[model samples]
Structure formats: C-alpha cells, structure tokens
Target: MGDYLVRAIGYNGQVRAFATRTTETVGEAQRRHNTWPVVSAALGRSMTAAVMMGAMLKGEDKLTVKIEGNGPIGPMIIDADAKGDVRGYVTNGQVHFDLNEYGKLDVRAGVGTEGFMTVVKDLGLRDMFSGQTPIVSGEIAEDFTYYFATSEQVPSSVGLGVLVNPDNSILAAGGFILQIMPGCEEETIESIEKHLSTIEPVSKMIEKGMTPEQILEAVLGEEGNVQILSTMPIRFQCQCSKERFGAAILGLGVKEIQDMIEEQGEIETQCHFCLQTYDFSEAELQGLIDEINA
Candidate 1:
C-alpha cells in the first residue's frame, strides 16, 4: 500500500526483475518540489528507476543518476542507496505543457530529444563505476532501457509511469525492470517480450491498487513463475543535515566565516534536496572560525 519495492527471480532464475509501488514516495517529492504535471512525471519516473537501481547495490554502496536533457525541464538529479532511500530534484520544476497526441503528458517534448543519461556509482573503497549513454528517448523508461543495454551490455525492459492530478499532485507512480540473465533460453526472452507488449502501463496498475508483487506477475505473465526474493520500504529520504553543512562551512576556512559574522551577522544554508534551512548564529560562526584557526 505504501511505497515499497520487490526483488524477484523469474523463470527459475533465468531472469532478474524488480517492481515498485511509489505513489507515496513520489507524492512527497511532488509536495517538496511543487513540480508541475509534466515535470512531475519526469522527476517521478527518474526517482522510481533510481530507487530500484539502488537496491542493486550492497552495504554502503550507492549511486547517482543524472538526466540532462535539452528541453524546458533542464537537468534532473537523483541519489539512491542500497537501503531503498532516494532523493531527487529537477532544475526547472514549474514547467508543463498540454497533452500529446496520445492524450498523455508530453514528457518527450518537456525532456527534449537529445542529451545524455549518466550513472555514477560509489562503491566505497575509492573504487567507482560510471556509465553514460545518449538519451535514446526523452521518456525516462526508454532512456534507461538504452542505458542498460548499451552501457551495461544487459538486455532489459524498463517501464515507468507517473500520473498527476489536475491540482498538480501525484495520482500514481510505479515501475518495473526486467533483465535477461546470461544463458537465458531463447523461449524465455521471447515470452517476456510478448508480455511486455501487452501488459498495461505501470501507472495504471498502481492506480488500480496492485501491489508490487502483483505488478511483477502482471509483467512476467505467470503468477507462479516469479519467486520474490526480498522486499524493502522506499521513500523520499534526504541525507543532508546541519552538521554536514557545518563541516562544509568549516572547510570554507576562517575568512569566509569572519566575513559572514561581520558583514551578514549570521549565516543561513538551505538544502537543495529537502529545502530545509539551517542558520548559524554569530557565535556559532565564531566557533567555526576558531576551529579553522586552531
């Protein structure tokens, strides 16, 4: 019912899949960013995919997905960890347009036809992994599908959708990712492709109150074929805090804090992820200066 993702192996481990119901998670982001309808779709879809990709990691590992398109929405960034926590934002959240020919949000027009999607992974031992591919389609799902196939060399099917209300709130948001494992039979891949063509959109399934497990079954087309491995709660979670920002201020050295104490009397910092503001009094600034001086 709430936001959560499921991991499963289908066709007796010949395929790996992930499904998530992210309505509440995307709703929280919609409220925080006040994104318009089209922009909401773009940001929500990217966040949904990012959280699933995060689940692919382990321990302290994490990743960031950057979508830089040439349209009005500007660049979007999402950060996610292995723990099912995610946070994201768009450079321009107030942009929207009329529906396209299919009577759906014009996400392609809002995202533009060219640009790049990049993924950066932090593996926590100074070892990093990064892959980038041109945005094959401004639609978030196709772009990720291309990313995995071309960048990671894995054949994948990605379905992402977000529906917004007239009042600019999120109605439903969810997605599924299906990847063919090495040595998968030709028959299995053909069957999955056939189902992918017929299954309803991910947003519609979520709107109809389907659970993540049910969504996976719908995509895989066999209720008994999926073996759910794990489930984890997902949400719009930001890691920024006052202490983290304070350390950043201290890294700015003594003169900057002194200037704030004298010229501005205090310093205030606002987090881009959550828009939460942190203020440091003149005394607090002085203490930071002392720490820098010491």
Candidate 2:
C-alpha cells in the first residue's frame, strides 16, 4: 500500500491521535542511503514519526527533527512539511549490529544512549516552537515520547516500528502518536495505556495490511468514537535541485569557481537525502563565475 497518514480525534475530542504507513517511503530511503538493518530501523522510525507530526501543521509550516547520538549510526536529521512531504539522512547509514536480546533490530545500539532528540517547528511566526530532551532510550519511540512530555509539556504515547527484510531492505514501517489533551478524563488515559501495551508492534500491523485508520482503531479501541480530520499521502521527498545547488556555488565566490575550473574541469555536487549527484561542465562553472562577479 502507498504511504499515508491520518489525523483524528477520539473520545469526544479529548484525545488526539495520529497514524501512518511508511513502508514504501522507508524502502526508498534505505535503498538511496544503502543503510544496514540496524541503521535502517533507527532512521526509518524517526522519519515515520516526523512525517506524521508534520501533518499537524497548516500550509507552509514545516518541522525539523534531529537525533544527535554518539553511536555508530551517527546523527539522524529529518525535515517534514505540512503537506506530508519528508526527507531525512543519517551521518552513518551503513552501521549494522546483531539482533538484540528480543531478536529485534538493535536500534538502541545503532542510535546510542547518550544524546538528545530535538524538534523545531516553524509555524510561520516570529519565533519557531522548539522542544528537546535527553535520550531516554535510543529506541526512537520512547525518545519521542519523552521529548513530548519534557519539552512540549504534553503527555503523549508514541509507538514507532520498522521491520527489516532479510537482505536489509525495509519490509514495513509505521507508527502512531496519541496525546492526551487538557481536560482528558482519568479513565480515558488509563484505557489508552491499557490498550497500547497489548498491541503488536506498529510495523507488524502495517505488514498485516492495516491502514492508518486501523492502527488508530486498535489503539483507541473499536468502540470509541473516532472522528477523522484529514488524510494525506506521505513520501520521501527532497526539495533540492540543480538550480538551488547552483545558487549555493555562487555563494562560494567567483575565485572558487575559477579554482574548480582549473583543478577538476567540472564540478559535482551530491544531495544527501536522495544521494543524487549533479554535474556542471567547465562552461557552466564559468557562467556561474560571471554571475557571481556581476
């Protein structure tokens, strides 16, 4: 199924929930980055959660999530917009490790235990909203949950999962976030916690053909009244292009362009998100140099 996410309200608006299916999106990132199993799981989980959070905003709004850990996988960085477009990259996407004691991907080992997870939201305001917290666990879900509670001061439950194929490709990837809004009843909080602990991993549910709505239903229960707000397609999208990159070269000044023309005869630039490379001929570099001088 295609990647998508939904936002909804349950229990008469006291509980806000989000769910997403990101298998294809994660698969694309895995192939582009050539990440190993553990690295794929760690990065995929954060991208899944970031894309869903991006859905919480209005037009033109965007958010950036950063996982600065001291592990072999290095830092994880993701950018998502209100339109369900997201792109991310890891400092070390080729890190791998043996399965954990539970036989799952060693996300904790790949992500490291000492670091911080931060989210910066650009709401098109004078000051962007920012939240951050030390890593409670290198497991992405718990870390996100802690970020919400400690930084945003919102009580929330997060479940993020990514299942890797035997060959290190992404098999399934998805997650959910259920936040208790102000004035939520005690019973509602208890009910959600009870159900969350028993549900299967989010990736497993997505692998079983469950939609985003189904994931919410499983978490909120089949009986609760859930009102869907919006549904949007989610994918691995990067906003980098040759023209934009050309502008970057112009920023390096005219002499640098001349230096490149002398040294390499051409220039090559690569996008980290998709790993796509762009080449400019010597003439093109000369043109940029003229523009920079002008």
Which candidate comes out best when scored by lDDT? 1
Q: What lDDT score is found at residue 281 in candidate 2? A: 97
Candidate whose TM-score is highest: 1
Q: Write the per-residue lDDT of candidate 1 for residues 137-164, one digit (tens) a residue.
A: 7999999999999999999999999999
lDDT of 2: 0.91
Error of 2 at 85 (Å): 0.8
How would you encode candidate 2's per-residue C-alpha lDDT over 1-294 as one tens digit per residue?
A: 699999999999999999999999999999999999999999999999899889888899999999998898888999999999999999998886888999888899999999999899999966699887898889999999998888888899999999988888888999999999999999998888889889988889999999999999999986558888989999999999999899999999988889999999997899988888999999999999888768
